[model samples]
Every structure is written in C-alpha cells, then in structure tokens.
Target: MSDFGLGVSGLAAMFALMILRMPVGMAMLAVGYFGIVIMNGDRSANALLVTEAFSATANYSLTVIPLFILMGNIASATGFSRRLYEAAFAWVGGLRGGLASASIVGCAAFSAVSGSSVATAVTIGKVALPEMKRFGYSDALATGSIAAGGTLGFLIPPSTGFVLYAILTEESIGQLFMAGILPGLLLTALFMITVTLVTLRNPEAGPRGAAVSWPERMRAVLRAAPLLAIILTSIGGIYFGVFTPVEAAGIGAGLIILMALVMGKLPWGVLTDAVLDTVRTTAMLYLIIIGASVLNPFLALTQVPATLGEGLTSLGLGPYGVLLAIVVIYLLLGMFMDGLAMLVVTIPIFFPIMTGLGFDPIWFGVVAVILIEMGMITPPVGLNVFVVKSVAKDVPMSTIFRGVLPFWFAMAACLLLIVVFPQIAVMIPQAMFR
Candidate 1:
C-alpha cells in the first residue's frame, strides 16, 4: 500500500482503539509505534519510542504543566474558586439572569488559575449550581452557563490547551497566552450577552436575587483579591516579559500554596491530594505529548500533511475558504472525540496548511483553542456538559445539552468575529512582544 494510505489506516486504527475504550494516548502510541515499524524498521521504531518517551518526560519546559496544574488544584482546594464566584455574584446577582451571568464571570476568573475545563466546571458548578437553583434559575440557563463558562479555562491565560499547542507547534507559550486574553474576554462578554437575551425572552427562567450592599460587594472583592493578584502576576508577568511561562507557572503555584497555607485552608491531606492530582494530570499530558511525538514522525514519513496541504491549496478555495473548511471539520470531530485527542491527531495535518496560507501561528493557536473550547460544550461528547451534569445531578443530560445551545452559538459568533478580524487574537501578542 502507498505511504499515504498507510497513514490513513494508522489513523483509522487509532480511532478504532479509542472507540474500544483504550486511552487516547495509548491508542495513538500503539498505532504510531506499529506504523513506524512497518514503514521503517523495528530498530528505528524502538529508538524513536525510547527517545521520544524520555525526552517528553524529562523536558524542562514541560515542568510548566505540573506547576500550573498544582496551582489550579491548590486554588480549588483553598476555596479561591468559591470566593471568586461569591465576588462575581456580589456584583451581578441583582441583574436579570444575574446568577447565571455571575457563574460565567466566576468561571472566567477561576479559569485564570485552573487551566482544565473539567476543573473549572466542577469547581464553579459546585459553588454556583446550588445558588442558582435556590434562586429559581432554570436548569438549562444555570447548567448551560456553567458548562459554557468552563470552556474559558482552555482559552484564558495559563491555559493547558495553549501550553500543549505551543509544545506541539513550536510557538511561544507566552505569545499564545497573550493572544488568548482578548479573545477569551470577548467570548466571556458574548456569553454574558447570551444570558441577558435568554433572561429577557423568558423572565421566568431567571429571577434576579436581592441587590448586594455596596459594602458587601467591596468585602467580596477584597476577599478574592489575592486570587486575582495571583492571576495578574503570573499571566501579567508573562505578557510584560517579566517572567517566562515556566517561571510564571512556578510562581503562581508557590503563591497559591502559600496563600492556602496562610489561610489554613489547605491542610496536609488536601495538599497531598493536590500534589497527587498534579502528578497524575501532568503524566497524562506527557503521555499524550509523547504519543504525538511518535505519531508526527510517522505522519511525516508518510507525507500526509504535505499531501493534504497541497491538495487543499490546489482546490482554488482561497486561504479563507480552506480555513473555513478546516474549522468545520474540527467542529464535526469535536462532537465525537476528546479535544486534546483531536488536536494531537489533526494539527500535524492542518498546521502546515495554516502557516503555508500565511496565517500567523499565534493567532491560529487562539482560534484553534477556541474551536476546542466549543467542542467541550458541544453535543453528545461535550465533556464540560457532562462535568456540569455530574455537579447538577438532578438535572437531566438533555437539559444540560439544551442549556449550552445558545452559548454554543455565542461561541460560534466569537469564532466568526475572530476570523473576520484576526487582530482580536493577535493584537495583544504583538504589543506584548513589541
């Protein structure tokens, strides 16, 4: 069979394994290794496997993964996430559909510290779900807001999605982080607008809570100040070139731990659990990275990316048209596959096409992350929807899915805006570098 055909078969096999309940990393790894052995030789495959595994695990830059994960896990343990929710609630809870809006705001804030969508959804959902339910918020709006807001974790600064993208694409992590900031905030605003429209259309869906006193609002803000400071210091430091991504992650993790300790919020057991969770998450990420490392070379050897890029370019679709097609493909894949799995599998094929079309890598990274975020809340496989479901157990899965539909369109609008005006994704990164 032709090399390109073999590559296609390898991908098919990987998906089949995934469907059979094999882990994503292992599925990719198994296919990649066997594909290499068939295409090259056993010696080459063995050497590649050993080298990629060791290098991916030992790389200093990868340390950022664990540190950032630790920061997020500790932030959750220390009740920082709850405080953020309270602070946002204090300001917005009086508005129509305000509790739901506050959940979005709080999720955005928590996302700064927690890079995982699941983490953001679970943590914020725990805090906001009960409050929204108590205040007579509809199940759909309440659950939808949390699920959609959780997606911000992937688009906001300190994002694991950006970190993984940077590692894969060889783009600067800091630049990607900066590029995400404006788009992230923009999407957050769009989500808030969606909530307002929803509440307006059906006043019974969301009843406003009593207005918080100015003094209470001030106190809530003050209480959440330290968490906000950590976000600004870590993410802000990266933008200002005051710290590298790794250094920022370390500092953020250390500060979070310190704050938790000082507040006596992080007991020994909680600290230990945080550390273990970080280790597990970091390991999982490394496995995926290593799998991608192996799969990339196999795909390269097969010349699939080059062939795909050339085929698309030859279609006379123009660059924008080709990009739109790619975006559509991602949206479809996202409905069935895990986001990171989709990224690791497809980027090798698409990144070259994007760059060859003269698109900026950093901007593309932001766009790609946003697409992945959409998948997190999109249909049957929407992981964030499930996470929200887990928290709002009383709510039906169908209800949660129904809730995210409007926000899903809001995301689509955000994506469209960024596509038409690429500056939304690149302007901050450019200024930061300049």
Candidate 2:
C-alpha cells in the first residue's frame, strides 16, 4: 500500500480501538508500532521504538512535568483552591450569576498553579460545586461553570499543553510560556463575559446575594495572596529569564511545599497522596509522549503530511485559510478524542504545516492550546465535562453540556480575536525574546 493509504488505515484502526475503550496511549502505541513494522521490517521498528521511548522519557527537561504537576497537587491538597473560590466569591457574589462567574475566575487562578485540565475540573469542582449549590445555584450552572472553567488550566501559564508544545516543536518553553499570557487572560475575560451575559438573560441562574464591603474584599484578596504570588513567581520568573522553565517549576514546587508546611496544611498523609497522584499523572503523560515520539518518525518517513502541506501551499489558500482548516479539524477531532492524545497525535503533522505556511510557532502554540481549551468543554468526550460529571452525578451530562454552550461561544470569540490580531498571542514572546 502507498504510505498515504497506510497512514489512513492506521488512523482508522486507532480510532476503532479508542471506540472500544482502549487506553489512548496504548492504542496509539499499538497502531504506530505495527504501522512502523509494516512499513519497515520488524527489527528496525523494534529498535526505533526502544530508542524513542528511552530518549523521550529520560530527557532531563521532561522532569519539569512531574515538578510542575507536584506543585499543583500540593497546592490543591493544601486548600488553595478553596481560598481562590472564596476570594472570587467575595468580590462577585452580589452580582447576578456572580457565584458562577467567580467560579470561572477562581478556576483561572487555580489554572495558574494547576496546569492539567481534568485536574483543575476535579479540584475546583470539589471546592466550588457544593458552595454554588448551597447558594441556590442550579445543577446546570454550577456543574457547567466548573467544567468550562477547568479548561483554563490548559491555557494559563504553567500549562502542560504549552510545555508539551514546546517539546514537540523544539521551541523555548520560556517563550511559549510568555506567549500564553495574553491569550490566557483573554480566555478568562471571555469566560467571565459569558457568565455575566447568561445572568443578565436569566437572573434565576444567579440569585441575588449580599455584597462584600471593601475591607472584606481586601481581606479576601489577602487570603488569596499566596496563589497570586505563586503564579507571578513561577510565570514571571520564567518570562524575565530569572529561571529556566524547569527551574521555575522547581521553585514553584518548593514554595508550595513550604507554604503548606508553614500553614500546617501539609500533613504526611496529604504529602504522600500528592506524590502518588503526581507520579500517576506524569507516567500517563510520558506514555503518551513516548508513543508520539515512536509514531512521529514513522509518519515523517511516510512523507504524506509533507506532500499534503506542499499541496495546500501550492493551492494558495494562504496562511489564514490553512490555520482555519487546522482549527476546524482540531475541533472535530476533539469531539471524539482526548485533548492531550489528539495534540500528541496531530501536532507532528500540523505544526510543520503551520510553520511551512509562515505562521509563528509561539503564536500557533497558543492557538493550539486555545483549541484544546475548547475541547475540554465540548461534547461527547470533553474531559473536563466528564470530570465534573463524575463529581456531580446528580447533573446529567447533557445539562452540563448545555450550561457550557455560552462559554464555548465566548471561547470561539477569543479564538477569532487571536486569529485577527496575531499580536495578541505573539507580542509578549517577541518582546521578551528580542
């Protein structure tokens, strides 16, 4: 068979395995391994797989993943998530749909610390869901807000998506981290706007609550100071070249541990749990990376994506059209596949096309992260939605999906803004690098 035909068959087989409930990492590994063996003989394919997995996992840079994840886990265990929600609620609870809005803001703040989408959903949902419900928030509003808000975890700095993108494209992690800032803030604003508009349209979603005094608001902010400081220290440090990405991750992790210990929040039990959780999460991420590394070389050898890129370039669709097509494909794939899995699988093909078409890699990384942000709140296989659903079983999946509809539109608007004004995503990185 032609390489293109082999690529197509492999993709179909992978999807079928996904449908049958196979683990995404394992499924990708299986298809890629077999495809490589078929394309080349078994002996060469085995050698490549062994070398790829070892090199990909053993790289010192990948250690940043576990450190960053540990920082988030420690923060979550230490009750920072609760403080964030309280701080947000104190400021916005009086407004219509304020609690839900606050939840989104709180989630964004948490995202600065916790870069994983599903982790953010689970952590924030645990903190905000009950409080919102107790305040007479509907199941749809409360659950949906958490689901949608959790997506910011993948956009905000300290983001795993940005880290992975940097690794895949061979871009500087610091530059990508800096580039993500404005886009992340834009997404936060868009989410808040969605919440405000929903409340304005139907006040019932947000019951009138008591406003906080200025003094109390200040106090609430003070309570949230640790998280704010942590974010600024980690992200700001990286952007300003005060530290490398891994160093920043280490500093952040250490600070989180120190704070937890000082506050008497980090008991032995919690520390143990955090370590275990981080290990499990990191292992899963690395497995996906290993699989992708094995497959990427094979895909490159096929030369199909390269040929397609040339074909598209020759058609003169221009950079914008190519970008639009990529975004559409990402959105469609998101409905059926996990965001990380989809990113790992497609970025090898997509990033080359994007760069070949004259798009900035840093800008494209932010764009891809935003698309993943949408994927987390989208239907069928939205990971964040499922995370929230697992916690709030009383709310049907469909209602949670309905609740995120407005926020999803807001996300689309953010995407359009970045597309129209590429500078929104690129300026910080360029300024910093220059």
Candidate 3:
C-alpha cells in the first residue's frame, strides 16, 4: 500500500480501537508501532518507540503537569476547594440564580489550580449540587451550572489543554497560558449571563438565598486567601515574565503544600492520597504525550499532515472558511472522542494549515480550546454532563444535558467573540512576550 494508504488505515484502526473501549494511549501506541513496522522494519519501530517515550518523559515543560496536578489534588483533600466555593457564595449567593452563579465563580477560581475538566466538575458538583438541592433549585439548573462551569478547568491558566497544545504545536506554554486568560474569563461571564437569563425566564428555576453580611463576606475572602495568593503568584509571575511555566508550577505546588501544613490541613493520610492521585493523573497524561510522539512520526513518514494541509488549502475556502471547517471537525470528533485525544491527533494536521493561512498560533490555541470545551457539554458523550450525573445520581442524565444546553450556547458565543476579536486571546501574551 502507498504511504498515504497506510496512514489512512492506521487512523481508521486507531479510532476503531478507541471506540471499542481500548485506552487512548494504548490504541495509538498499537497503531503507530505496527504501521511503522509495516512501512519500515521492526528494529526501526522499536527504536522510535523507545526514544519518543524517553523524550516525552524528560521534556522540561512537561514537568509542570505533575506539580500543578499535585497542587490541585492537595487543595481538594485539604478542604481548600470548599473555601473557594464559600467565598464565591458569600459574594453572590443571594442574587437570583445566586447559587448557580456561585458555582460558576467557584469553578473559575478552582480552575486556576486544576487543569482537568472532570476533576473540576466532580469536586464542585459534590459541594454545590447538594446545597442547590436543599435550597429548592431545580435539578436542571443546579446540575447544568456545575457541569458547564467545570469546563473552565480546560480554558483557564494552568490548563492541560493549553499545555498539550503547546507540546503538539511547539508553541510557548507561557504564552498559551497568558492567551487563555481573557477568553476564559469571557466564557465565565457568558455562563453567568446564561444563568441570569434562565432565572429571568423561569424564576422558579433558581430562587434567591438570604443575603450575606459584608463582614461575613470579608471573612470568607480571608479564609480563601491562601489559594488566591497562590494563583496570583504563579500566574501573575508568568504574566510579568518573572517565571517560566515550570518555575511557576513548582512554586505554586510548594506554596500550597507549605500553606496546607501551616494551617494543619495536611494530615498524613490526606497527603498520601493527594500524592497518589497526582501520580495517576500525571502518568496518564504522560502516556498520551508519548503516544503522540510516536504516532506523530509515523504520520510524518506517511506525509499525512502535509497531504491534509494541501487538501484543506485546495478547497478554495479562504482562511475563515477553512477555520470553520476545522471547527466543525473538532466539534464532531469531540462528541465521541476524549478532548486530549482530539488535541494530540488533530493538531499535527490542522495546526500547519492554520498557521499557513496566517492565523496566529496563540489565538488559534484559545479558539480550539473553546471549541473542545463546548463538546464537553455537548449531548450524548459530553464528559462533564456524565460527571454531573454521577454526582447527582437522582437527577436524570437527560435533564443534565438539557441544563447544559444554555451554557453550550454561551460557549459558542464565547467562540464567536474570540474569532471576531483575536486580541482577546493574544493581548496579554503579546504584551508579555513582546
């Protein structure tokens, strides 16, 4: 078979394996290994696999993944996440749809630490779902808000999505992190507006809570100050060019540990559990990176990326027209595949086309992340929706899907704004890097 034929077959097999419930990394590894053996030889395939695995595990920027994850896991174990929610609630819990709005705010704050969407959804849903239920918030509104809000973890600073995009496209991690700031905040605001409109249309969906006293609100902020400080130091340091991503992640992790210990929140057992969780999450991400490293080379040997780029260019679709096509492809793939899978598999092909079309890599990273975030709340396999279902077991999955529909629209609006105003994604990054 021609190299292009081999590449096409490999893609088919990889997707089929993933659909059959094989782990994503393992499927990519299997396909890439065999494809290389077929196209080259067994020795070449083995050597490529070993070298790529080592490269992925040893990459300096990749170290940021584990440290940031450890920060989030420790924070979750030590009740810091609860304080974040409490602070958000103190400020906004009395407004109409206040609890739901508080949930979105809490998610944004937590996303500054945790980069995984599922973790953010699970953590916040556990806290906010029951409270909203007790306060007579409709199941749809309560569950929907948490599911939609959790997706912020993928867009905000320290996001794994941006990290992987950086690795795949050879872009700057610090710049991607900075670029995500405005778009992330934009989506968060749009989500809050969705909640407001929902409550406005059906007042019974989300009723107001008792007002919080100013002193009480101030106290709540004081309680959550440790995390706020950590966020500012790590992300702010990056923005000022005072620290690289690796340095910022390490500093953030150290401060969280020191603060937890000082506050007596780091019990021996809790620390152990947090470390184990971080290892599991980090290992999974590293495996995916390694798989991409191996698979990407095989795709290169077959000239798939170049061919796809030429095919895209040949369609007479101007830059924006091609951009729309790529967006649709990502949205469709996201319905069935995992977000990280979509990133590693597609970026190698789509990224070149985008940059060749004169699009800014940093801005495109923000736009791509937003599109994937929308899929996380899209129906059927929307990962966050299922997460909310697991938390609110009594609430039907269909209801959770229905609840996220508004927020999904909010995400689309955010995507539109970023498309029309690329500076929203690039301004901070440009100011910092220039």
Candidate 4:
C-alpha cells in the first residue's frame, strides 16, 4: 500500500482501539509501534519506542505540570478553594445571579493554580451548587455557570492545554501563557454577561442576594488572601520574568504546602492522598506525551501530515476560509473526542498548515484552547456538563446541557473577538518580551 494509505489505516486502527475503551496512550502506542514495524522493521520500532519513553519522562520543563497540580490539590484539600468562593460571594452575591457569578469568579481564581478542567469544575461545583440551590437559583443557571466557568481552567495561565500545545508545537510556554490571559479574562466576562442576561429575563431565576456589609466583604477577602497572593505572585512572576514556569510552579506549590502545614490543615492522611493523586495524574500525562512522540515519528515516516497540509492548501480557500474550515472540523471532532485527545492527535496534522498560512503560533494557541474549552461544555458528550450532573445529582443531564448552551455561545463570541483582533492574544506576550 502507499505510504499515505498506510497512515490512514494506522489512524483508523488507533481510533478503533480508543472506541473499544482502551486508554488513549496505549491506543496511540499500539498503533505507532506496529505501524513503524510495517513501514520499517521491529528493531527500528523498538528503538523509537524506548527513546521516546525515556525522553518524555526525563524532560525537565514538564515538572511544572505536577507542581501546579499539587498546589491545586492541596488548596482543594485545605479548603482554600472554598474561601475563594466565599470572598467572591461577599462582593458579588448581592447582585442578581451573583452566587453563580461568584462561582465563575472562583473558577477563574482557582484555575490560576489548577490547570485541569475537570478538577476546576469538580472543586467549584461542589461548593457553589449547594449554595445556589439554597438561594433558589434555577438549576439551569446554577449548573450551567459552573460547567461553563470550569472551561476557564483550560484557557487561563498555567493551563495544561497550553502546555501540551507548547510541547507539541515547540512554541514558547511563557508566550502561550501570556496569550491566554486576555482571552481567559474576556471569556470570564462573557460568561458573567450570559448569567446577567439569563437572570434579567427571568428575574425570578437569580434573585438579588442580601447585600453584604463592607466590613464582611473586607473580612472575606482577607480570609482568601493567601491563595490570592499565591495566584498573583506565580502568574505575575512569570509575566515579569522573575521566574520560569517550572520555577513558579515549584515556589507556588511549596508555599501552599507551608501554609497548610502552619495552619494545621494538612493532616497526614490528606497529604498522602494529594501526593498520590498528583503522581497518578502526572503518569497519565507522561504516557500520553510518550505516545504522541512515538506516533509523530510514525506519521512523519508515512508523510501523512505533509500530505494533509498540501491538500488543505490546495483548496482554493484563502487563509481565512481555510481557518474557518479548520474551526468547523475541530468543532465536529470535539463533539466526540476529549479535548486533550483532540489536541495531541490533530496538532501533528494541522499545525503545519496553519503556520504555512501565516497564522501567529501564539495567537492560534489561544484560539485553539478556547475552541477546545467550548467543547468541554458542549452537548451530547460535554465533559464539564457531566461533572456538573455528578455534583447536582438530582438535576437531569438535559437541564445541565440546556443551561450550558448560552455559555457555549458566549465562548463562540469570545473566540470571534480574539480572531478579529488577533492582537488581543499577542499583545501581552509582545509587551512582556519587549
């Protein structure tokens, strides 16, 4: 068979394995290994696999992932995440749908430390849902807000999505982090607007919360000061060039641990669980990276990415038209594929085409992350929606999905704004570098 045909078959096999409930890394690894054997020989494939596995695990920059994750896990365990919501609530809870708005605010704050979308959703949802319910907020609004807000985890600084994007594309991690900030804040604002519109139309849906006294608001903010300071210091440090991402993550995680210890919040058992969870998550990410490494080499041998890029460029569509087409394809695949899976599998094929078309890699990274995040709240297989359902058990999946639709459109709007004014994504990074 032709090399291109062989590549197509390998992809089909990988998808088949994934559909059969095999782990994503194993599926990619299995396809990559045998494809290499077919195209070359057993010895070549063995060497590739061994080298990739070792290099992926040994990479120093990846240490940031575990450290950021540990910081988030410790915050969740010690109730620091809860205080973020409390602080936001004291300030905004008096507004219509304010509790839900505070959830988005809390998610945005927590996302600075926690890069995982599911973790952000789960942590914020658990705290916000119960309180919103007590306030007689609509299920659609309450559940929808948390599910949508959780997506900020993927678009914000310290994002795992951007990290994987940087790794796959070999772009600067700091630039990608900078690119994400404006877009993240923009999306957060859009989400809050959606909540305001929903509550405004149905005034009964999100009632005005009792006004908090200025003294209580200050007190609440004070209570959340430590985590807030950590968020500012870590992200601000990266912006000011005071620390690299790995260094920032290490310092942030260490500070959180020390705070928990001093406050007597970290029990021996909780610390053990948090450490074990971090290891488990780090292992899974490493496996996925190794699988992508092996698969990329095999795909290169088959010339699939090059062929795909040629095909995309040959279509008479100008650059913007081609970009729209890529966006549509991402949306369709995102309906069924998990966000990270979509990133690792598709970037190898699409990244070259985009750069050839003259799109800024950093700007595209922000757009791509936002698009994938929208999928996390999109229907038929929305991961964050399911997380919301898990937290709000009595609420049907349908309600959560319905609630998420408005926020999904809000994300779409945010994506459009960033595209029309590409500088929004690039400005922060450019200023930082200059």
Model 1, residue 135: what's the lDDT? 92
lDDT of 1 by residue, 99-119 (tens): 999999999999899888889
Clash pairs, candidate 1, are none
Stretch of 10 with least lDDT, candidate 4: 333-342
Q: For model 2, where is the 10-residue window of minimal lDDT?
A: 201-210
lDDT value, residue 429 of candidate 3: 92
Q: In angstroms, what RMSD does candidate 4 have relative to the true structure?
A: 0.9
Candidate 2 lDDT over residue span 110-131, tens digit each: 8888888888888889988887
Clashing pairs in 2: none
Q: What does candidate 4's lDDT look like per residue over 371-392, in tens digits?
A: 8998898777788998888899
Candidate 3 — worst ten consecutive residues by lDDT sum?
Answer: 374-383
In terms of lDDT, which candidate is strongest? 3
lDDT of 4: 0.92
C-alpha lDDT values of all predictions: 0.92, 0.86, 0.93, 0.92
Give candidate 2 misplaced runs (Cα > 4 Å): none
Candidate 2's displacement at residue 269, Å, is 1.0
